[model samples]
Target: MAAHFPINHHLRPLYRLLSALAGLYMLVFGVVGFVQTSGAEFFTRDEAEWVLGLRTNPAFSLLSLVAGVVVLGANLIGRNVAHHINQLAGVVLTVVGMFSLAVMQTEANVLAFSMVNVIVTFILAAVTGIASLYDRVGSLTAARAEEAHRHSARVA
Candidate 1:
């Protein structure tokens, strides 16, 4: 599996920038949601409360803030740490999205997740996962050799 992933990919900077942007978006969304849902029950499932076009509650807002900070911090850290964090966040977000989807209409929707929230979660997950794939750090020599190997393998 490690062999299948590229090392020191040329597009790493772009992916990192995208990931950082996603984190920033999340941070802003969380803050706005937190402010909008203030004084409401932490886990209230009120559909009337929305932020950035997505339903939210205090609990969800707090969670989003934490997640955003973690992602942003990882991106700033860069290298293997960012890669690992992005991968983990992707999996976690996917699971959260799936769970939210499953409980969308029921009373268990503590997050007050709307359909759009699920869609956004999946999109963010994909972005973070893709970013992780190309965020590896390595020597240029090793990268060149690995690229050559991959090229040869493709031709064969």
Candidate 2:
């Protein structure tokens, strides 16, 4: 009585949806930044580049858009792929946010964003990243439990 191929436990669809939404937000944010500003400079935090008080530049916007696309695309591929994508994005964004905070007043950040903006990014990163990781671990544990149950039943 070996355990069946079907894995009963898995991450909820919400995690996948959240990841997709994050990506869409980045893509739209980039497009909106472009539309809102006339100067297509490679990098600037001028008032014109402000979207809801968060500064954005061509490079920043492009990067966000790319990240979003990657996340969304991963979700389309499969649950495992999506989980990995969220995990990767989480680590990157968390680091980026912390870096931004460290260099908030410095000129090192060409993609300088307001402190509030940076904080928001960190929150998003943490939420999606942690949730996906939790879901993945839970699913794995459930699968293992099911396998153990099946093994014990056959032994009995």
TM-score of each: 0.90, 0.76
- The number of the candidate with the highest TM-score is 1
Per-candidate Cα RMSD to the true structure, in Å, reads 2.1, 6.3
lDDT measured at residue 54 in model 2 versus the true structure, 0 to 100: 65
Query: lDDT scores for all predictions?
Result: 0.88, 0.70
Model 2 Cα shift for residue 146 (angstroms): 7.6
Report how far residue 121 has shifted in candidate 2, in Å.
1.1
lDDT by residue for model 1 (11-88), tens = 988998899888888899899999988999999986438788788899998899999999988999898888999999
Off by over 4 Å in 1: 1-3, 152-156
